[model samples]
Target: MNVKLILSTFLFGGLIIFNVNALPASLIERDGDTSLGTWQIVGESGVNAMHAFLVSARKVVFVDKLEGNALKRPDGISAISAEYDLDKNEARPLSIYTNTFCSAGAWLGNGTLVEAGGDNGDANFRSGRQTVRVYDQSIGDWYELEGIMPSMRWYPTMLSLPSGNVLVVGGSKAATGINKEAINNPTYTYYPPSGTVMEDYPLQFLAETLPNNLYPMVHVMPNFEGKPIIFLHANQRSISFDLGSGKVVFEYPKLPGAFRNYPLTGTSVILPLSSIDNYNARFMICGGNKAYEITSEGEASCGILDLMAENAEWEMNDFGGTPRVMPDATFLVDGTILFVNGARTGFAGYRKGGGANALWVNENPVLFPVLYDSYAKTFKPLASSIVPRMYHSVSTLVPDGTVLVTGSNPQGGVSLNVKYPTEYRVEIFSPPYLFSNTPRPNIISLQTFEINKERIKVYYQQIVTLIVQVAGGEPSFKASLIHHGFITHSQNMGQRFVWLDVVNVWMDTTVTDQYIVTVLLPPNSNIIAPGPSFIYLMNYDAPAYSGVEVLLNEQPA
Candidate 1:
């Protein structure tokens, strides 16, 4: 990739700059200290089927059922507020709001939340109506907005435009109920001449302008230039809505190679322009079931589509792993798309137990398929989650770069109790490490440093010293020491960089894989008690990405 080309059209404020310098896989983690990994359990009941939204201010929020029976008030879908720590290896919880059993919701920029179709007792209360909820973060509560649709909807597509307007599209509204009218009647939500607006806005909107009667998939374009486009997978149609003027552009491109079932809705991600072609914008869609077995492999469809040019269409492509539907895909800071936790086959259910054509079983393994845009044609099998997850909510990169993954079917949802479990638990992947997972030998045992009060001379030594300290994963000793505080001068060398574990300096001069190095304390040195000093004795190996060993005084044996 050209550096000039990369810097020219940077997104999110040039947060990621392409450099000619090669990146080492081991140290590939995002910008944060690996030592401070933190995660707080926000909801305790196993939340398996939930959705997440990122606030305009970059806060991550989601709604999930509480613990116990899958259906219950207060236990229904609630709002969870969290902040990410770029340096720490974890996420800390801020607040949670609950009022309905929401299946999906989206951030309306200014901390407002727009949710569609959730169960709220009486079976016909909202009647599949589209409800908008505004949450005040400062107060940690929720306010119900007045405009209620006549029908009920679940898992509908909702997006907030850059212009601060909100767009709600097709979803499975109740087949019958009070809100059912909302779904049956599209004119109530769209603009005049097309549809009527129930709520008063600074501007008048038409319902027909929206993708009425369709559960559209809305994704914001990268570089923050284009308006939010809604892909009505239900009708195999796509529409671009310009909120500025309340206009809609239509494009009907039948995806080639497969006949999609009733619900064409699938997950779509904005891939880098270079992934599919040298020119124009490209996106990857995955996890939709087909009525007919189209491919020879019986694998579901996985392909790329060009969204920037005219007559945009889907092009078949290679998949690094098994076909997953409703999988949660997130864009890694390194330009990699990570797909985790999704069902193997169809919408029917989990593919567990012994079956001739099981989509996935325990032995089949639930793995993390990482698609590196740099390696567009190939998908790499990365580490799997500690637990198997399906229909889960995975968060995009926080400012710190760690992915926050939560919720999922505990075990294929085979057990009745396991269905749609809510998860207060979450996990994060530390950035990749440069070195393979090989245990480093304790060649240099003295991994600690301290100051003595007798003070005239500084003393340092290692508990175990090996002859080949600078070999293989051994530390090297060049006698370079760094002190965080204090000063060094001729009368008393200013605080100098010193290593206590480094034993000797004599070693192979040619080898560069220095892992650890130790050194002895200088003579006649004034010692500062409680003040810590660090000495690094290594051949010349660059710092490991993480899991760095730091020696501290009075710490342990």
Candidate 2:
């Protein structure tokens, strides 16, 4: 017998809301989990935004933002000893240095912090020299080194080489951050004109090209052979550069979409706890505003890029349902990427308005955790939090596998006509499955189809596979073919199975007994849709929800 078609439905007030809208898409909680606790209020500095680096000894070294050019700037390096209890969430500040502008820096194995920019108290630009400042944490002092690139700089990026040397790349010196022709998408009107492109000025073209105002994000791939490589997004171009010899190793590769929407920042770290195989160490970039009006919404979206390969080629897949900018991201132990504080599209005037009204105003801001499945090439938005923020600091709590997230808009500040208090608030993100006793997954979407219709086929895009997984019990599922355009009652009975896979066959799972299962495609129907089949998972008393997801396999199906 064919399986009786079941469509997941929701209830409102006193009526049943049949979910024809929520099909084929679902989110389930994994048994694994982790968290980052807000333990200590290490001495605070002026409100600032920056990324932190984890040392071999687990020590975290970062530069404190000092008052510079009237804007919160990095004056010197600070060390945070790792003695803080990961469990108790207790922390203490080690030391902080004075006036220094380090657009970027990294820690060498020998205990010295190699910083780009200059030693004099100024932005990477005023110093007019891209030299390395070596700071010894043991003595709380810094020494300057000349003989590197000579000229003023800004937006400098640096990385520690395996040989104890540091690789610094990309920064411009013109009054505007980028070259004249390198204007950001005209939509980001708030960008300071001079800060936009800093290529040529009244003086000699400082160094070489002007500051692209772009991040030359550096990462040492597990297979990197002593060479320093960085993935850079120049405007919308994805290019890879070798820092050792200061040259563009690879020109550019096309992305699924433009890179302007979500620009790359900070460094890439390998996710240690996910079941991900092919992209064992996935590189992530998040929260940059997209070029406006170029697309349907006149807004952009958030996306991630896979940086595992050696070639300059890359792929961008959207995740954040809306556009976000200047947000910080960290990898969780379970392989999930924690996208902390960022601005949602509605809050546009906050940073891009080019006026006093450009501060973020998110009353009751929602923190939406984003999870990326590399194997699946899809993104899911997890539960929300109460942190409304943009340009905040986020780091991984490696020992306990939690993320240490802190700093965002404080109280009593207004942006775009919205007011927020400068916040010293910090919190932890623990997956619900591990922390909550009643792990229940929410139903997100559902869809139904005919078995034999000229157009109702699943193989339209070479997709002939149906995959499903039951969270707690066996999944008793079913499907039926339609005669011409008419529907039929069909049911398939079998022993309980946690998962199900069938080739060119109308099938279902024992939802009440299974955890998960996927549909397998037949080689013959590569370009044709599979016969319509009504799918159902046995309803459970214990909230067993399901939804559909489009898995865009990297390779052609």
Candidate 3:
């Protein structure tokens, strides 16, 4: 029996919903068991989460484009900035004066989320269009950075560079009217107001990619020589750009078939790096489409490229499972990738002139989650979700190893009559590890020394010890720094994963039942970019991860 066929039948045949409180241990022990993972409808988000990021270990901040009175929102709210507390399962509304629709953001070294540019709506055009807003997660406050960006950007992409600065890439001057003739700002600028900016950089590449390349897949990887280079891919084209001089180092071979960017939305993840591979980097792009017709099938092809190889070319792999569009692939703490959300047919977004049911062309929602094993090069379909996360939906891996899946608004505004109506319900997918009877390793404390009398910093190549209490056998742990990117429009800008080097592991002599794990930080910023990274500890089985500890890598200024 084909596993995909059986899994599809199990999903469509109304699989029993397992009680969140009473998950069986047998279900958990099924390692790499797709059926063992389960989903629980935790709570409802009051607003549609067009964009989402894990602000803290316990809190998630979700935002949607400004809808004014279209969607019933709290009074005086121009845009919904809802902070969802994972522990409490409660969402609280925060006031955002600017319209943050189609904006881009990345976490700064200070652990503050810096979002730049947004919609050009009339309501808050002055503040929203060109505004740069920063949110302090520690204080639950928002601050505006005045006069930062050089232009008004909608549908822009923001990436955190290895230099601890953010690079803002291609965006249209206006919203959604993307075409060949549309005005596209093909240059990139820096955050924190870098005096020198690269204007008209790679203008032809962005122009040729056009409407489909709104959110380009950009990865900062070390080349064969270990120098940092930016890999920019959109649609069928890919280019390696040198960061220092703003020149194209090399143009990668075209993707085999179908487009993997916006409208034709797929998901991508930079495969986990390891010492065995000599830290050579590879990227995988999966599931997209070439057209927006209802009859158009979602692309089941996956393209991968090894950046460090001498003559690297995209290797295509066909997944004989469900074809998905607008999917979200989140890199889990254990180095496995969790693929969720998106639709089976039709492109992203709602139809402008179609009738009620046909408002959103993407009908079949890929409810089942797939786990991609980078090492094994295989896809395992996991538990299915009842919610249909298409169009503007977003998903991110929480600190505790659960995937927080939210949002799906195909309509331009709130409409109950549409087929795939606007969704505010938030669901949490508990991976097989969470179902295990074995207790997770608990982090007792993280020891860090103060630098510059201003902030705590983890120095490069220094051994850092984390005190953790293990419940069962001797602990064999892995340290990972997962950067949960600002997710919007199928592009997770600045999303990255770095498997930290383990120096030593031994039991704590002073404290019984407790052990100390010593890990070496990346030798330089090029290997693992310096900024805010969520550090997680996973034991031998890789079953569950301890709550994340935010680590800042900084050299004293």
Steric collisions counted per model: 66, 82, 0
Q: Lowest-lDDT window of 10 residues in candidate 2?
A: 487-496
Question: Candidate 3's error at 7, in angstroms?
Answer: 42
Off by over 4 Å in 3: 1-35, 68-75, 124-127, 145-148, 196-202, 223-228, 353-357, 448-456, 543-545
Better of 2 and 3 by lDDT: 3
lDDT of 2: 0.34
* Candidate 3 lDDT score at position 181: 41
Q: Which candidate has the highest lDDT of all?
A: 3
lDDT of 1 by residue, 1-557 (tens): 11111122212211222232432234233454423233333333233325554332134444443323232335343223333333342334433333234334443323245554444433323322455565564554445543365445443455433333445544444432112334432321321112454432221122332222233445443222333333333324445544445455555465554322112224555453221232234556555545322221222566676666677766776445576544556554334556555545443222344344433321222446454453446666665555545433454433233455665543333244332333445565533421223222223333332221111122322233222222243222222223221100000001112223233333334444323222433221112111223332222323211111222222224
| Poorest 10 consecutive residues by lDDT, candidate 1 | 486-495
TM-scores for all candidates: the values are: 0.54, 0.50, 0.88
Q: Which scores greater on TM-score, model 1 or model 3? A: 3
Models ranked on TM-score: 3, 1, 2
Better of 2 and 3 by TM-score: 3
lDDT of 3 by residue, 415-485 (tens): 65656778888998888766556457777666643211222356666667777776654545667767788
| Candidate 3 clash pair list | none
**Most accurate candidate by TM-score:** 3
